[model samples]
Target chain A: MIIQVQDLVKRYGDFVAVDHLSFDVAPGEIFGLLGPNGAGKTTTIRVIMDILAPDEGEVTVLGQPPGRAKGQVGYLPEERGLYRNLKVLDTLVYLAELKGTPRGEARERGTALLERIRLEEWADRKVKDLSQGMQQRLQLVAAVIHDPEVLFLDEPFQGLDPVNVERVKSLIAEWHQAGKTIVLSSHRMNLVEVLCDRVLLINRGRSVLYGPLAQIKQAHAPHSIRVHAADLPLDLPGVIQVQPDDGAFNLTLVEGVDPKGVLRELLDRDVDLRAFEVAPVPLEDIFLAVVQDEDESEEGVNGLA
Target chain B: MDWRKVWVVARHEYLHSVRRPGFIIMTAIVPLFGILVLFVGTFFAGQASRLGDFFVEQFDSTSQRIGVVDRSGYFTPILPEYRERFLLYEGESEAETALLAEEVTTVLVIGEDYLETGRVVAVTKGSGFGSAAVSDSGSVRGFFVDHLLAGQVDPALQRRAANPMSVEPRVVSSRGESQGEGAWGFVFTFVVPYVLSIFLVMTIFISSGYLLQSVAEEKESRVVEIVVSSVRPIELMSGKVIGLGAVGLTQVMVWMLSAVGFSSGAVALLAVVGAASIPARVLILGVVYYLLGYTLYAILMAGVGALGATSQESQQLAGIFSMFAAVPYMISGFLFANPNALLARILSFFPLTAPTMMMLRLPLAEVPWIDVAGSIILLLLSIPVALWAGGKLFRVGLLIYGKRPTLKEIWLILREG
Candidate 1:
């Protein structure tokens, strides 16, 4: 594992920002840290980067205590900011130098990275002179200027448009192909679904779901199928519920029943089936389901008390 | 501690701050203002002397002559110089008539009992208080001395009687070292150190203010997280303190050098401060105290600044320490009267007040070597402790946004550290 967090607990006074959170990121893979706003994603990343101390539990990076591998780890915080008075290239160089890169090499890499982001012309301009999108790109360059082996990017796509988001995604892909570990924290489920291999979904400082993205989706995959057929029977064998879905009828099977059985039964009833396919739940629906489940449970506990 | 990272941060901070428009303007303003004051002072001094000469020339004009009525019987002859401005009249009524006609600016009447009582009166142009003629009274007295002693004594003896004596005072220290002549030397002895101490305090505050502002900016702008991810909080704080200290030093050096370069008063000031009461040790001590004082305050302020949610709030939070720095100045009268007083000794040992208090005291009195060493040691020792506490506060505070920490929370943070 490139990054390992175990039983991590952090609090800000009365507020528990990260409560008994445990997860690990394998080396050379993209791991999504999925959470809603105020869901302890930023705080957890801060702890892993050694930017904040955990009130309890332990975090290790590169098989060492947090912060021991300083130059090897990179972080782009959720709240993006840079020295507005500094030139674009200079800011990147300074940040790189702080991570132990010498000035000459840092500047060279900074220049190259600026070119990669198409900000080479703005290299000599002050950061304040750059527009918001330009600054965000420059900030991303700053994160990777030192070429660290492991990176933690919090909400890296928050302020980006689709085109820029695709640009950043491609950049991440290039790094991933180069065998770097990435812990990407974002509330953007669509991006996470497209990019993440493994994920840790957290809600209110506690883990909601954790594992390989495929396994979690497989485990939470509803036993349902969508059928685009005429005169579909509302009460089909082994089907518990049916609902209209985007010009198709979604049929929910019994808990132990397979969608193949329902499909065969549909064919046996001689339904004019135009289309039939298993419906895979989107990560967004799963995220909403898990979060709402946690909220309803907490409310029940509160009412009992 | 990574010295390399610290150096990088320090260098970046120094360059960034020094290039700021605010910093450049502030740095230039001090020396520029000093030069302006020097030129204006010299111009006014020259104009004042020229105005004095003009007034004398005007008073000596024929239209503004003095009428002297000699009623005393002993008067045989008036001197040649006295004849230039004074016209002897036979009676007071005649002199009074010349005064009313504006032919004379003043009229002097000698009483008949001059030998016994030496009574004389002056009559001038107006009947109100401004009519009394006292501006050129010294010349009139000189005239009296020249005439009175004319044939009574030898010329040299008469000259001696007229001018009296000239006193040249030289101070000798307890060690029998000579502090060069006159009251100006003694005045410089107190004034120079007092002024330098004020400069030291101002520089420390200004520099520490830069540190505060720098920390506040990083926090407010949300850049600190990225920076701190590469460097330790202590390293960041140390770098900023060292860097901004240099900035303050640069500012003070420019002002001091400009003072020495641009004005004759500063040259005379150095001469008196150096040749008279102040020894060279004061300058060395001044630099040492400034470094220690700046580090101590800068670290404390870095913590306080990080705790604030905004730069303006940080400045407001810093006001308490600012007032504390002024304590020595507030009680400066006692310091001047008794540099080795108990209160002065107490302030000298305190880290916050020590720099200014000791600067004021060093030139004024023979401060014991133990106190000097102790104060410096105390100041030097307080810095690391401040760095520890401040670094902790700064570490957590940088990540805290939107809300300023409460007193209890700050205390908790300190305790946690």
Candidate 2:
């Protein structure tokens, strides 16, 4: 594991920010932490970055605690903080040096990153003078200029225009391709769905779902099949119900019935089926369902535990 | 704690300050203003002294012209004995005409029964110069008349009134140098202390204000978080204090040099006027007091600055500290009268007031060696405590968002840290 957090807890006076949360991110994976605002996502990231210490449990990054591994990691906090008075290149190089990069190399790497982000024109401009999207891009460069082994980004894509969003997404992908461990946190599920391979969904400081994104979606699969046919039957065997809309039918299968078997039966009935798909539930739907479930479960526990 | 990191922070701070138009203007303009004010003050002072010297010289050169209309014949012989010091006119009309035309300065009229009444009245025509000049002329005439009266007293009465015993003053110093007696010590004790205190307090006020405003600006802009992540809070605070303190010191050094240059010119002017020179020890004590005074106020100002959330807030907070600094000023009248009194001694050892009080007393030669040593020790000890508290407050205050912290909140923050 590149980062391991065990039962991490953080309290501000009597308010608990992170409550007994545990998770791990494997090397070379983009792990998404999906949550709403004030859902402890930022607190967890801060704990992992060593910016804040947890009141309970342990956080180990790359086989050591966060501080020991700080230089080997890069963190882009949820708060969009940058030295507005500093020139873009200088700010980037400063952050790189802080991560233990030598000055010469940090400058060289910072320049390269600026070029990659198409922000070389703004190299001499103060960060304050740049547009919000441009500043966000510069922040990304600051995070990655040191070539950190692990990158922790909180809401990295927040406030980005679509073009810049795509640019940032590709950058993350490129970093992951270079075998860097990434922990991505965002409230937007679509971005997380496209970028993340594994996810940890936390609701009110506790993990509601933790696994590979594909597995989580499959586990929460709805009992529905997509059918495309020139003429569709009103009803079929092992099909409990059907809804025809938008040139296709959403067929609900019976309990314990195989969707593949239903598709085969539909094909044998001489139906001109243009397509057959087992309408896998979207990760967003699963996330909402799981979070809702956790809320209900908490209400029960709040009455007792 | 890393020197390299501290240097990095310092370099960044220096660059940031040097690049700002405000800093550049202050760096250049402050010294210029100081020089300008000093020149203006010196010009006015020189003009006033020249006028005074001219009046004294005029009085010494010319004797009073008196027209005595004494019908009693008692003053007939009295005028000739001191005739060289008096110009006698025959009639009041003649004297009045001479006085208006700026010839005779006085006219004395004695009644026919003046010997029995012993009554006299003096009058002079106005030169239209104003009442003050006329009053001054009257005073000068009074001096001459009093001397004349004393000279005319009975010989036996004068003999009896003369001092019965006299002792010749002697000095037995090995150096045989004459000890100067004048208000110079008072100048050293009162004026020097007051001026030095103002400079010290102003330096702290200006520099700490700059530091606090810089911090608050960055915090409000959310830039402090970025800087803090790279450099420790101690490094940031120390760098700012040192950088702006350097600026303050530069202003002070320039002002001091200008003052020294002006004083040297004044000394040359004084030589021409035959006035005593300003002592070298006075200048040395001024410099010593300035340094000591600055150190005491600068550290405390830095602490007060850290608790402020904005430039305006820092300024308001600095006002309170400045009031504390002004305590010595408020009580300086008492200090002057009793330089070595109990209150002065206690204030001299108190770190906050010591720099100003000691500087004030040093010129008087009233500050004991032990008190000076003790004050220095106390001042040095307080510096670290101030820095530590300032650093802690700065660390917490920089990260705080939204509402400004109260003193209680600040205490809580320090405790948390």
Candidate 3:
């Protein structure tokens, strides 16, 4: 593992921002730090980046303490900012130099990054003068300019336009392929679901669920069947609940019922069915279910108090 | 520590700040401002001297219903010019009555033995009173000289009898050498010291103000986090101070060098005002004090900026330190003349007022090297402790938004860190 966080806890006065949280990122894997607003994802990223210190437990980046691996780690904070008064290229070069790259090499890499983003003409232009998409591209260049071994990106796609979002997604994919360990945190669950190898989901400073995305999906997989039936009441003996969805009825299956057996029962009813499909639960459903459960449980506790 | 990074940050700051329009205007004007002020002052002085003459010319009168109390008849043969302006009377009572009755606006009393004693007292009714030395032929003194000594005495003696002698003093040294006693002694002893003291304090305070502003701007704009994550807090703080110090040094050098190189009038003015004796050692010390003082204040300002939620609030908090910088300058009037006064000496040892207080005293008296060195060493030594505590505050507060740390909290943070 390139990064390991064990039982990390951080508190500010009466508020605990991160509570006994533990997670790890293997070398060259894209790990998604998943959470709602104020769920301690940014705080955890900050601790691991060494911008902040964890009050309890251990955090190691690149097999060393957070601060010792300074030059090897990069961070893109949730609230992004650059020197608006500085030229785009100058800002990048300065950031690169601060991360231990020499000025000459930094300039060259900065120029290359600018060209790749088609902002080479804006190299001499001030950051404030750039369009939002252009500035975000430059921000990305600044973050990864030094080729840090591990990159912590918080909401990296927040302000990006659709086309540029695709562009940024490709850049992140390319960087990941180049053997860089990346920790991405964003509200775009589908994107995270598509791109991340593993994820750690937290709520109210405590972990709700964490594991490889495939395994988490498998563990929470619900047995739901989608059927396109003509002239049908859409009720089957094995069905627990039925809801209409996009010209079809999606049925929740009862426990211990075989899908094959349900299909046989549907055929016996002589319903004219055009399509039958068993769909794995999407990540969006899982996120909502987990977060709603947390909210309801907290409300219950609040009522008790 | 990490001098390369320090240099990099310093170089960037210097390059950026020096290019600002405000810095440019200041750099271009500072040296010449002193000379410009001198020219302006000289012009005003000249105008004031001519003010009396101009008014006298404006009030020149042809009609005279005047009373002259000439008991010795010194004006028995008064010149026609004088007669037009005066009506002489032989008795003091008559002259007094005419004066009181408003028959004349003034009365001139010429005493007994007027030929031997050239004293004349003119009393006026509150108009044209201080133009006593306007000794033209139309003047009262010229009238007395022309009337009393027409071809009876030599012209030079008559001229001497009319006006006070003008003297230019020069002090002769024990080596039999003499020099013109200009106000240069006062200049070197008081004015120069005051300038240096204020200079030391202002440079430190103002340059550090710029540091405070830039740091606060970075923090507010959210660039500090990215920068801090890459570089250590100490490194960033050190770099900023070093960078801004270079900006200050560049400006001061430009002002000083331009004064020496371009403005000969400024040097002449200072020389004429008795500032020629200012020792080079004092100036060199000014430079040293600038570096140390700037470091001290810059670190403190950074600490304040870290703890403040915004630049304006940080500057408001930093204002108290600026007041500390001004303390010695504020007390300079009381302590400058008496360099070894107990209060002055006590203030000189204090780290807060030491640099400026030393600047004021170092030139006026024969200060021992130990005191000078001790004061500088003391200021230098205080910097590390300041940086240490300030670094703690910076680390703890840089990422915090919308909250300012209190003094007790800062102290506790210091203790823990």
Candidate 4:
């Protein structure tokens, strides 16, 4: 495991911020830490990053303590900021140096990263002079200035416009291709779904779901198929209902019915079908469903108590 | 502690603070302003001296005369040199007549019992208050003293009797060497330390403020988390303390040098730094206390900074902690009056007030070596404790946002740490 967290618990006074949380990330894989606001995701990351100590249990990065492994770990904290008084390039170089990068190499890489972000012209300008999106890009550059082996980016796309978000997404993709382990934490399910290989969904400081992204989507996938067809029959065998969905028809199949059989029925009816596919649940929908389930279960436990 | 990282952070903080417009302006403007005041002062002083010399030339003693009526038989024959200014007469009526005619500025009557009672009366035209009265009285007294010892003593002996004594003090060392600095030496002994104490306190105030401001700025900007991820809280705090202390020392050195430079060029005030020598021990001790004192306050202000969520809040919190440093200054009068007083000694031993207290007391009197050693030892001991406590506060407080911690929470944080 590149990163390991076992039975981790952290608290602030009487409030438990993380409770018995456990997960691990493999090298060269994108791991998603998905949760709502105040769900202990930040606290968990802080403990993993060794910014905050865990009240109970253990965390090890690269078979060592977090502090020892910090040099190899790059972190972009959820609360994004840089030295506003420092120049853009200088801030990146300083952060890189803090991670034990040599000044000459840090400066060289920092300049290259600035150029990569198309921020070369703004390198000499103070960070405060940059627009919010530009500063966000610069912060991203700072996070990876040392080109660490493992990167933890918390809400990396926050405060970024779509173009910049795409820019950041491509950078993350490039890092993953270079075989760097990454723990991408965000509540934006679509981005996480597109980028993460495995996920750990948390709510109220407890894991609500954990597994491979494809397996989770498969398990949560609805019993339906999306078909783009005109003149589709509502009263077809093994078809319980039909509903219009995004310029297509959603066929809710009966229990134990194969989706392929529904497509066969549509073809026999001579329906002009433009497209057909099994409707996998959107990660956003799965996220909401799991969160709602957790809340209701919690209420049930509270009611019983 | 990661010495290299500490060094890096210190270098960064030092450069950052010195580069700030606020620090630059404070360091530059104060000395420039001091020079301006000195030049302007020298100009006015020159003009006043010239005016004074003109007045002296116009009103020299040749323009005034005094009428004396001698009943004591002491003025049987007026001395030839006194014949110009002193006009002798037989009775008080003749002297009064000369005075009414303005032949003399005053009339003096030496009584018949002058040999027994030593009484003399002077009459002058009444003007509410004037320098004329002072000059007339001086002339009459000189006439009486000069004649009182005419044949009984030598002229030099009479002159010595009239002038009395001029005191020149020499401080003797244990090795039997004596150094006399006269009045300027005394002024320097008292004034130098007083000024040094003020400077030490100001440096502490300014440097500790920078530490607090630096911490508060990092926290307020939400940049502390990223920085702390790569280094410990203690390292960050130590770096800021060292860096800002250097900046404060730089500022004070500039001011001191500018003071010497400006004072040297002036006419009337030039003796201040030139004639008064600061003891080597005081200079060394001043630096020692400044470093220790700055560290103590820097840790304190850093803790205060950690507790505050905003720079304004940190400043408010600092206002309370600053009262501790201000205690020495507030009671400076008592300290000056009695340098080795019990209160002064007690304050000197306290880490918060020690630097300023010692600065105030060191020059006023010979502070015992034991007390100096004891206070320094106490200050040395206090820093680690402060760092521990400050680190606890800093570790937890730097992460909290949008609200100040309550006393109970602070206690809990310390306890937990």
The residue-by-residue lDDT of candidate 1 on B305-353, one tens digit each, is: 9999999999899888787778888888877788899998999999888
Per-residue error for A44 in candidate 1, Å, reads: 1.1
Interface RMSD of 1: 0.7
TM-score, per-candidate, Cα-based? 0.82, 0.75, 0.78, 0.82
Better of 2 and 4 by DockQ: 4
Tell me what TM-score chain B of candidate 2 gets against the true chain B.
0.64
Q: Per-residue lDDT of A32-147 in model 3, one digit per residue for the tens?
A: 99877898998898888888878999999888998888788888888778988899999999999888899999999999989988999999999999988888888887888888
Question: What lDDT does each candidate get?
Answer: 0.82, 0.69, 0.77, 0.81
Chain A TM-score values for every predicted structure, listed in order? 0.90, 0.91, 0.86, 0.89
User: How does candidate 1 score on lDDT?
Assistant: 0.82
Please give, for every candidate in the order listed, the TM-score of chain B alone compared with the true chain B. Answer: 0.68, 0.64, 0.67, 0.70
Considering only N, C-alpha and C atoms within 3 Å, which residue pairs clash in candidate 3? B184-B273, B184-B274
lDDT of 4 by residue, A1-305 (tens): 99999999988878998999999999999999988788899899888788898999899999998788778889999986788889998898888888889999999999999999899999899999999888888888787888888999998877778898889999999999989999999988787689999999988788888989999987787888888876587788998899997788888877778788887877888899999999667787998987888779989999999
- Using TM-score as the yardstick, the better of models 1 and 2 is 1
Better by lDDT, candidate 3 or 1: 1
Docking class of 2: acceptable
lDDT of 2 by residue, A1-305 (tens): 89899999998778888899999899999999998788899888867776566799999989998766657888776766687788998888767766567889988988898889888998999988999888888888787888989888888888889999888888999999999989999888777777889999887788888999988876778878888887887668899888887998888887768788987887788889899998767677887888787778889999897
Name the runs in model 1 displaced over 4 angstroms.
Answer: A232-248, A256-271, A298-305, B21-162, B167-198, B251-278, B331-346, B363-371
Which structure among the candidates has the greatest DockQ? 1
Name model 4 segments beyond 4 Å from true. A226-250, A254-261, A268-271, A274-280, B21-158, B169-180, B183-190, B249-276
